[model samples]
Target: MLYRVSVSFHKNYLTIKNDSIEIGIMEKPVKGKANAVIVKQIAKHLGVSKSKVRIIAGEKSQDKIIEVMS
Candidate 1:
């Protein structure tokens, strides 16, 4: 499955609506830290492993595209 994600910093939250997700992450967008958290959170929410979640686009931006393998 693929999802369109909008990320927010300094807050911790995860919401799913249709094909898009709104994620409020506490980590800063530096050195892949925030991205890693994004993957982890989404995986947990979807009942999948971190390895099954991948950010395929928008690594440096708030909006991202992620792929999850079932």
Candidate 2:
């Protein structure tokens, strides 16, 4: 499955709205911390492992496209 997520960093909470997954990360978007958090959260949300989740695009942007392998 593939998902397009709109990430909002530094938010108070995480939210899932419609087809988009919103994540809140305390860590800044430095050293791929936010990206790692995004992958982890998505994997948890979909009941999958982190290795099964990958960011195929927009690694350095707020909008990201992720691929989830089942």
Q: Judging by TM-score against the true structure, name the best candidate.
A: 1
Candidate 2: residue 45 lDDT (0-100): 79
Write one digit per residue (lDDT tens) for candidate 1, span 1-70: 8999999888889999998999999898889999999999999999999999999999999999999999
* Per-residue accuracy of model 2 over 1-70 as CA lDDT, tens digit each: 7778888866745677666676777778998988998888888878999999999999999889889899
- Candidate 2, residue 48: lDDT: 94
Query: Backbone clashes in each candidate structure, one number apiece?
Result: 0, 0
Q: Flag regions of model 1 displaced more than 4 Å.
A: none
Candidate that would win on lDDT: 1
Ten residues in sequence with the least summed lDDT for candidate 2? 12-21
Cα miss at 22, model 2 (Å)? 2.1
Report how far off residue 69 is in candidate 2 (Å). 0.6
C-alpha lDDT of candidate 2 relative to the true structure:
0.83
